[model samples]
Target: MKNFIIPAIDLKEGKVVRLFKGDFEKTKVYSSSPEDMAKLFEELGFKRLHVVDLDGSLEGMPLNLPSIRLIRKAFSGSIEVGGGIRSVETCKVLHEEGIEFFVVGTLAVREPRTFERMVELFPERVILAVDSKGGKVAVGGWKEESSTSPQELALKYENIPIWGYLYTNIDRDGTLEGVDTKPYVEFKGYTKKPVLASGGVASLEDVKKLMGIVEGVVVGKAIYEGRINLRELL
Candidate 1:
């Protein structure tokens, strides 16, 4: 079966970088030019892009509109953004700005009512992000842990109009040790909704392994550092 290719763009103060073990304090700046990186991927023919605003992740609202606009334009394809989205108002605006989908992490884990409202209003326009450590959902850039298990909330939203879940292993993100398959396998027998796997992906085999569990996969450090080629994947 064919799977979707979702390239990751983590923005911090207007540049692309990847976090190690979910630490925002110790990010390695991979691309000084996000537009260039996005354009390159678009040129390689990817259908959609996964953009995470690291600053937005912390601030609870989008901080890099200009750069996001540049990336939105550069790709000319679907862009599913996750970061600093804490309100229905914010969701409405970005949705109008041409964002194909929104990924809500911390808010979803804390305020299930808000997430439900978002789904009721936007339907398939939202994607709940599950970035976890030890199978528990981690929010606030992985600094805060919720009592909720990733699978539980995922299963709850299974039939909701939410688009999918972007599953990332906080410990494996930017580690390049290889992609984490444990949490995804945990999701088995739970929800039929698609999962978009993220973090620590270094090669095509990793992509192949995540095949059925995810609707797509987000590649960050690997593509930037040259461990995998977008040309080969897309």
Candidate 2:
């Protein structure tokens, strides 16, 4: 199996930024133009991109459609978007706009029936996001904690056609330390679904460690903070 080194573009009010441990107030602005960042990632030969709308995640609805459109128009590579994706209509709108995958959190755990319906409608395009803190799932932009565990949630979708599960460790997010590989290892052990690891990927070595174990790793703050060089990683 081939491991993917995916770059991330977290958008807040149309600008690209990264939040510290999922906190909205503690944000680090990277670039003003998400389109430029997307193009740069494509130019660097990254095959995939992860775009999240921070504002939308907090607001419970997409707030960066224009930015998403601009990034899609600028880069032709595979793009997966998440944040504020609660309804099927939002998924349709994004799919029509050229997004190849939809990452759904909060709603997937809160409303499994609705998420199952979306998976039924868009088979391989939906990616279930299991954002967790203290072994429990976090929702609504990581502000609220849910009773469900990541493993519990992944098990619930065993019979569904979800593309995979995007597991993010909220504590390590944007900290630029190192990933807590235990959860991912445990998650992979429990299910056959493809897993994408996110949060606290601080160096190329960290990516290398996660490589075959996960289908992909989402690297955000490290790249923005110059801790890891994208050109070398690609």
The residue-by-residue lDDT of candidate 1 on 1-234, one tens digit each, is 223667789999999988888787778998788899889978888788989888888888999878888898888888998898988998898987889899998888888899889889999889988887877898886788888898887877888899878888877888888976877877755777778888788887888888876778888888788887766653
Clashing residue pairs in candidate 2 are: none
Q: Tell me how many residue pairs clash in candidate 1.
A: 0
Kindly list the per-residue Cα lDDT of model 2 for residues 34-128, writing each as its tens digit: 99998998788777899999999988889999999999998878999999999999999998998999999988877878888899999988999
- Give the poorly placed runs of model 1, Cα more than 4 Å off: 1-3
The C-alpha lDDT values of all candidates are 0.83, 0.90
Give the best candidate by TM-score: 2
**TM values, all candidates:** 0.94, 0.97
Q: How far off is residue 193 in model 2, in Å?
A: 1.3
Lowest lDDT block of 10, candidate 1: 1-10
Off by over 4 Å in 2: 1-3
